[model samples]
Target: MSQKHLTIIDHPLVQHKLTIMRQKDVSTAGFRRLLREISLLLAYEVTRELELTTTRIETPICEMDAPMLEGKKLALISILRAGNGLLDGILEMIPSARVGFVGLYRDPETLQPVQYYNKVPKELDARMTIVVDPMLATGNSLVAAIDLLKQAGAKNLRFLCLLAAPEGVERMRQAHPDVPIFTAALDERLDDHGYIVPGLGDAGDRMFGTK
Candidate 1:
């Protein structure tokens, strides 16, 4: 993966919150809270380059022109289950952004992603799409999700994740070089079972207390 296509958010606050989330003993409530807080920070970074325009507005004392977001509302596409965790927090910051979901599950034996559900807003070609998933271990799910989004007319797209593995990054780079990735931490690698090494285990299970 090219370094230019990936951004490692090494902010102290982000790292600190990620550390708490990675702990084995962290409670469901604590994990969910930290994920929300960290996602707000991530959302700020990902939306840094949003185009701005001036709009005339009246202040308490006088009328003035103020900067505001320009163009169509942004789209946030969550890669189902785990992605919902990140989606909620980012939505808190960008309540006006359009929301979408792609539901997929890994085939236990093949370790490949299988799409079961998908729903996105119309006119995707004009909006900046941000795809969110907690962990990018195998990259199959993300790559598949991107394929569907592109087929649906999404042109400008970005990927956001809490943690990523080297293999997953490489896979995504090969498949979708145009899409840049924003992540909190890039871990060592994927383990034998395709889980990210030193990662917060099973983000969905941890956040929802399923396991």
Candidate 2:
């Protein structure tokens, strides 16, 4: 199901890739590769609304108008660490897109986000910005990341992730209703430890081979 604030990408290829990544036995290399492939698919759905303008072009046989993305190149803000997994694949598709990073770690005890680093592109107000992160479990970190981006003059923004929890989706909706979320799946709920149940474990760990 989809709402104004959230979009679930249920493409068969995406689902198949996600299922493999969920298995505890999947190696770090395998998980990282799958995440990159899935990010390419998710990027399609998330950027569907990009404005386009026709540009005059010459074909071998004739001249014609070709559709091109309008305005300044879009900006992609990776939410650090795990977000880099998704960022890598999307960059392959939009090579000219601007890139930035925001680093925020969740405090295990309080389940809140703590910012540690941030750097974003200039002219955020004039470009469409998309925030990339692998998991949106508690939504605390994602929300905090977006908060910083807005403070930096970003007005148009979107959030993309591999998986999301209902609690996290609602948290984002309540906190930043203007931003839309795109994810491969919306899982059941978050566990007591603030982890998404049936989630693919810690995304950063699975992708980076770290504990």
Candidate 1 Cα misplacement greater than 4 A, ranges: none
Pairs of residues at least 3 apart in sequence or in different chains that clash in candidate 2: none
lDDT of 1 at 169: 92
- Alpha-carbon RMSD, candidate 1: 1.5
Clashes of each: 0, 0
TM-score of each: 0.97, 0.98
Global lDDT of model 1: 0.94
Candidate 1 TM-score, C-alpha based: 0.97
- Candidate 1 per-residue C-alpha lDDT over 1-211 given as tens digits, one digit per residue, 9 for 90 to 100: 2267899988899999999899999999999999989999999988987889999999999999999999999999999899999999999999999999999999988889999999998989999999999999999999999999999999999999999999999999999999999999999999889999999999999989999
Best by TM-score: 2
Model 2: C-alpha RMSD to truth? 0.7
Reference-based lDDT, residue 208, model 1: 94
Instruction: In candidate 1, list every pair of residues with a backbone clash.
Output: none
